[model samples]
Target: MNLKLKEKIRESLSAVLPITGIVLMISIFLIPMELGTIVMFLTGAIMLIVGMGFFQLGAEMSMTPIGEGVGVQISKLKKLITVLLTGLIMGIIITISEPDLQILANQVPSVPNMVLIITVALGVGLFLALALVRIRYKISLSVLLIICYAALILTSFFVPKEFLAVAFDSGGVTTGPMTVPFIMAVGVGLASVRSDKNSADDSFGLVALSSIGPILAVLILGCFYKPTQAAYVLEDVETVVTTQDVARIFARGLPLYAREVLIALLPIIVVFFIFQMLTGRYHKWQIRRIMIGFIYTYIGLVLFLCGANVGFAPVGAYLGKQLAELSFNWILLPLGALIGYYIVKAEPAIQVLNHQVETVTNGAISVKMMDHCMSIGVAASVALAMLRVLTGVSIHWFVIPGYFIALVLSRFVPDIFIGIAFDSGGVASGPMTSTFLLPLSIGVCEALGGNLMTDAFGVVALVALTPLIAIQLMGLVYKLKTGKGTPTERAVIADDCDMIVDLEEDE
Candidate 1:
């Protein structure tokens, strides 16, 4: 195995083991899962470990380089129109490449998948263009976020109740593995042209801004499309019994997800070739490496989708239903919180975002610290999501207050931290949230006979929302500790070689 791949797989195991342990404990102590279900969950855990490892490496090798190349090219455009057009086009392509978006779209039965996907893509494209412009000219990330979110909030009232949660969730799913590396890299590439103290700060918000676009787009879509009850294809956990059965199960799943992933990657591959042809930015060796990276990303995604959707989702739903039906169902809150705390560590994009933040911030924002903050955030979000699932409360109660706090803190944190805090909100809810958390919530909701759309669907959005506040709170602590300076100046260590990847050398 490649050394980097081995390291990534090792890191993934570190993230996965705790969650697997938690699930096993739940099955053993809290609830007795069927043997087949236990086997399925374990298989899924194995796949998640390997898939996440591959995905993270792929992002490093393929997505990051491509984003950097494109960002630089976009920044080099003389005409604003050219830049905007490029950003718009690239945003749509990359958003289409996102696996989480497809997962979310599939769950939504009211709107056609392609229609929802395209709308979200358009939204991401528009805001991505705006984000590029913001970086080019150095606009206030806080101000832009406020305006975009204010518009989003105002628009929500006009959207139907049934469709509201899904709308917000559209925002969350867009910031997954596929979009982040490209979006963040574009930010880095655009920022690279400038030699300013704030360039890094500006580089942080593209993901933040891009996250908003999908929500706004989907909300507008909700106005025209009346959402009905969601139709979920809950997996049957008892279908596979033995190791051969599991292999057959995974084998059956692999091709469909493989085809989907390949289709998702096709546009990006085209973009890569186009970038090479138009700019001659890559050497032949670079091209070869990139193609290899694409292959890694494809394989990783197929395995991940199979593990998450085929292997994990059914078990999550079953566990949720079992737990919900228990005598002291209140355990769902803390249990959900515990799972939330660890499951986030397993999100491939969370690692990607953390590495980027740690690197760009010169280790001031260490990955360990990020993990802690995000775990806490996710814990709170999951607890709240479970609360909603149990009591049938309004999502508006959480969504409105959460964003308000997150935005308010944006005023206080360092500019780069503001960008990071917002983007982390999105990155925190990647494939794992889509596959496991949402299904878990839905299972609880179904067991309780609650409204699925209103009660359960917003788990992704909640997962997206809480991290903003949590991270910004951490940012406030950092500012108080460091006492007023640019994040670059406040760095605890200077460009820690181990944390930061050398993009130029890699390319």
Candidate 2:
């Protein structure tokens, strides 16, 4: 009923309309889908669009500012114990609120969801403290990544092969819609304390570091237990008969999401309320605006999840199964690659991230450029993942080398890119990877008699990994073009690490 809410709904519908049209176009001309399925797809599309709109707006209003506010307040404190406790509490609370993590937790049969959730939360909490320490001490992002990854690779050999992908995905998905905006905002708020130009670079590696924690924790868990079974949880898809029925479907779906998201969102709302009461940091109007934003986010997430889980997820699974059942299972690779490319356009956290990168870099890293990098990164990861599904390739073969190249490249690229590239790694694996792509992979694996837990589980992890290389490679390219000396000289460093500074003092 409110004007802003109405505009968000309209915009969301408009944004998703083209996607709906594409699906309809394919159904009518390219693929002959059942009419009931088509209706289901459309209904899901509407929910997804509106849900994304609301969720993103809500993140902006409620999550980002609150996280930033906390960061700013926490930074003002001098006690080390207080900072550590805050990080632990915030990490636990935010990770618990992350629906994507919960989704992954529910799917794994070997580990209890609560156990996995707690382990992942502890991983995040520990690393969040580390991230804060890094910011406080101004630690080099590249060096820290090198050490963390070295540990990851060393652990890979000992951990069970089946759990590798899920472990990596755990890293990426933990930093989800609920966690990212707040965490990133906290980074910015903390970084704002320093007058140094390079402070913005420090704002980036929170998600990057937080990401490492889950992989390590999950890998350790993998060493302890082996999961031979895959749990295939089928979602309930709604059947719509008429155009009018779409409204009724959304109406029914909305309240359920409203309840769930409101519950998910309540902890942060309460935290901020208490925070504001103690600090008096926010104005009355500011609080009012955030409340409105929370409403938008709540409505958006509810619709988004409902639509994704109920509508698109089933279709994706069905399509994968159908395609795998055909003689042309190989087609799944290229098709998955193509979908991975375009679907990046639809990921809600990715959109926010790309916009943030463009803003922070003063358009030096354009959204178009960032999108291209992510599309390529995601495309390659999906292609590799699809190939793994077809041939039962171990995800470690791809991830270890991919990370090696990224880590090596970090030493060559600018420090800012080092931070952004690693952050982009996690950002690439948003809700879409978990909800749509994972299910799609699982469907194909189930049809082909491949181990779904081993083969299909790590698509998100791979998606998270490739961007580390792609974005840093972008930085490598930028250095080659703009650096004062020979490319060969810049590429190799023997002792003097400071020789590679391109624009060290932020432009």
Could you say which candidate leads in TM-score?
1
Candidate 2 TM-score to native: 0.90
Model 1 scores a TM of 0.94
lDDT of 2 by residue, 63-90 (tens): 7788888989989889988898888888
Each model's number of backbone clashes? 0, 0
lDDT of 1 at 326: 91
Scored against the true structure, residue 133 in model 1 reaches a CA lDDT of 89
Model 1 residue runs over 4 Å out of place are 485-507
lDDT of 1 by residue, 1-507 (tens): 999999999999999999999999998898898787788888888998999899889888999998888878887789999989988998998898887777778776688988988999999999999998898888899999989888999999999888888788778877888888888888888888889899888878898889999999989989898878786677767566678998888888899998889888998999888878889999999888888888888888788888888878888898889899999999999999999999999998899999998988889889988998899899999999999989888888999988887888787678988999888987887889888998899889888889988988899899999989878767766665566756763453223221222321242
Weakest 10 consecutive residues of candidate 2 by summed lDDT: 494-503
Query: Relative to the unseen true structure, what is the C-alpha lDDT of residue 501 in candidate 2, on a scale of 0 to 100?
Result: 32
Please list the residue runs of candidate 2 whose C-alpha ends up more than 4 Å from where it truly belongs after superposition: 1-31, 236-256, 484-486, 489-507
